[model samples]
Target: MNLYPFRCSLALMAMVGAVISCSKQTTDPMEMTSLPGDTVLNVNYESGTLSSGVTGISSTHASAVDANYMVQPGAKGSYAIAHKVVYGDTAYYSDGAYRSESDAVALPAARFAPGDERRYEFSVLLKDWTPWLSGAIHETNIFQLKVSGNSTTGSGVPLQVRVARNALRLRYADNIRVYNFLADVRPYINQWIHFRIDAKWTLDATGYIRTYMKLPGHSFTIVDEKTNYATFAGNPAVGNIGYIKWGIYGIQEGLTRIAYHDDIRIIRLN
Candidate 1:
């Protein structure tokens, strides 16, 4: 007479009411508000693993070397967006494979873990892209943030790269860029497209970071070119969320592309 611990205590009370309704959602954390993007902790491409922030891009400043591109979750709310091919790493197609239209490259796995609260949330389904000749289809969504000093290249650290891509913009080049507020939806290529990015720290006084991007179907553009970015934290180095990576970017080295990501959720916005 045990009902499997009463269905595991009602699935842990529906995952604690979906994380207290996603921390009491105030709306527009990046949109999609029904949660359950597949559970396990949610991260796309089939839960390779991602919690809330920190993926690719890094710099302790010694000629900067940072990397985080993670996606490993499939089956539950739809993930296996394909690209594990025969299993894992296989780089060498800056634009060579997919001869008929070959494009499938992914990245995201940054977590330096020190100060915490680096924010996360990215989604895809622009139909897995493929139009790179110039009309522009190098298709992107990689919030590559790396600021090893850009207050005029003093050498490094003093980081602050925040991107929302729907309402704000900032950039300070040790490395800082957020993208895609619909520069090319390609007629909703594969349909499911949603993106949510959240970051904390606000007073709007001295140091700045107010980047935003959101394309509610033709009507959102914050620029820098690759897409959207707003980064600049003049001088308080040594904090970490440390490089948040997303996927796909064969930008200027020859291009054919792929796109089809699902409900990627990483949260923490203030």
Candidate 2:
């Protein structure tokens, strides 16, 4: 009856088996899915780094730039990008964080053109924003469809999604003039908002710009819809190459703002 030796042998085998199981465990990184066919650009900032498609452009002032723009954890395992702009920033064009499909000299085929339909969608949560000034316009461009042009002459930016007086507004460039397309977004302030823009760029009478908004626990609502909207008339010299920019661009001094963006995507529908 040598049961002690038998028990010792059994215990040794169990320890060896546990060690083998532990050695087989892996710590490989998970693979991310590629953007869909229609999607020209998609960024959730889950990679903890800015994609090559995104670029941070700012003026000379160091305090107004978004030098720390990076991925941050969001709700339910999701992620988002954070952008901050400080007050009393003298930089004319501060924090021009943007994303484009390509940097080619010529306009990419994926970009929207005449008769081409496209959509831009994103989720924005305003963490902090300065109080709106009465009678005076304190605007900040949070999103824009910008065209390349001469900065000295000051001619560019065909479409702009601006936040002013705690309201979302759409500005489009005309012949030496900028007109407001929509100005009824004051209700969506201080909350997470889903914004969607549908545009058909045309030089003739068929062009149109449509915007949609969705608050939490509700479906998308059409905020603005316009037909025969001419966005490129003012800046004829503006290049065909266009891109999308999103971040806090302070128009006036002594105002600080912070926002979080998630699920930004651009799709070619035509």
Candidate 3:
């Protein structure tokens, strides 16, 4: 009996299967689920790479995940993640938009739901942020809680943090301004700015959103707050999953914008 040849063929087939499986895991862009009882995600970039809490990276440029998105030393600590976007960078575009951004996709547990109260805390350092040319109104979103999965159900961008026209503004949906956190951002350039957003996702009047910010030699203070209002989307049957994105995303303003993020923590407090 010649069983050696059969065993060799089986080994080759197993090796090929393993290779394909490993490739798929690394190449997949979507992570659909999270570990049970997991309610916290902390990324400090001290490990020199994205943590498992981050499912994947989304960007309009192919090289963005490799080149523009980097782990470096800066931002409130010895290590942080840098997000860089250049003007007219259109290497890869399939994110349903015409923009250059390097966004880290959060886990499914990070999503918001009714009765879900979450606290988002992160530190940002704007490296080269300047007012738009001639004070033009161009959107430069630094953080967003956008609808994922089924985009047709809920609001496109439920919440976002934008730096435009030399100020930082908090917005809901398309253009609803929740608050103007910073009236002037030029003074904070190249300086660390810490933010804490506490949101209680609800459809009725019980929902509330409280935002706090801090700078060097300062303590956290409430920048703005919305209480007794609907924090989540209006649709009760919304099928979309809410996820978090922290990075630079928006229209190009003929200038390279760079920002550093560190100590990003999301705690589900429901």
Candidate 4:
């Protein structure tokens, strides 16, 4: 005879349970604090420009709007940096390679000095990609950890994240030593692929670089890592410093490539 009050109690209990479920889904601790640290650079491209600790933008022959590189809506938040490269657009050159990149450079002062341990996290989306299924497009670098000042003289870049053979490749070359890692990425096209690089910039054998990757709706997995290896080239005493540059580089083939980058954070580990 008083079932109305009982029904009201049931409704209230349902609401409380729903609220708790929503709270648990929304406030995921792992998602929020997956990589917490002293952030030296945090850029989401939400400002529609290069923000945070970005020193400058380097693009080859970027005359028109969003030519080689521009901040646009795509990767993360409301905007991300778009890097584009077409065939025969190779006026700019660096490290003895023809480049068509819209690279974001982290100048010398913002670079990781010797004995620095840092975590570099970023997300990349391939809006349009010409796979390396055929032709002279053997490989293309999407990111680089370059050596500056007196450090090594070979590639001038110790670490490189590249796209090759329809796969994601990680290459490490310091002086005469070289290492490689590969993961097939054909099924992951047009989807966001997140990467994290924890590295110790050292000239000695005490340095290491561990790379992790995360797919959508999945946890991060360690794709590759190098230990007891040198992470930098040359000598710091001669003015060697290591810096990061991300964009599309080494597109020798006659195909158009477009990629988006966002949510880049460089955390000082030590």
Say which candidate scores most in TM-score. Answer: 4
User: Residues 247-266, candidate 4, lDDT per residue (tens digit)?
Assistant: 77777556777777888777
Off by over 4 Å in 3: 1-39, 51-62, 65-67, 92-94, 98-106, 133-135, 149-151, 234-238
Give the lDDT of residue 140 in candidate 1: 35
State the lDDT at 107 in candidate 4.
48
Candidate rank order under TM-score: 4, 3, 2, 1
Pairs of residues clashing in candidate 3: none
RMSD of each: 18.3, 12.7, 15.3, 5.6
Per-residue lDDT for 1-270 in model 2, tens only? 879999999999999998976555422101112236877766666665544234432212234346336545642135666666665444323335221111212325434545667777777767655557576787777777766654654546667777767567777764233445435454555567777887777667777777787777787777777777654432334445456666656545555576666667777866
In TM-score terms, candidate 4 sits at 0.75
Error of 3 at 4 (Å): 84
> What is the overall TM-score of model 2 with all chains considered together?
0.67
lDDT of each: 0.35, 0.59, 0.68, 0.68
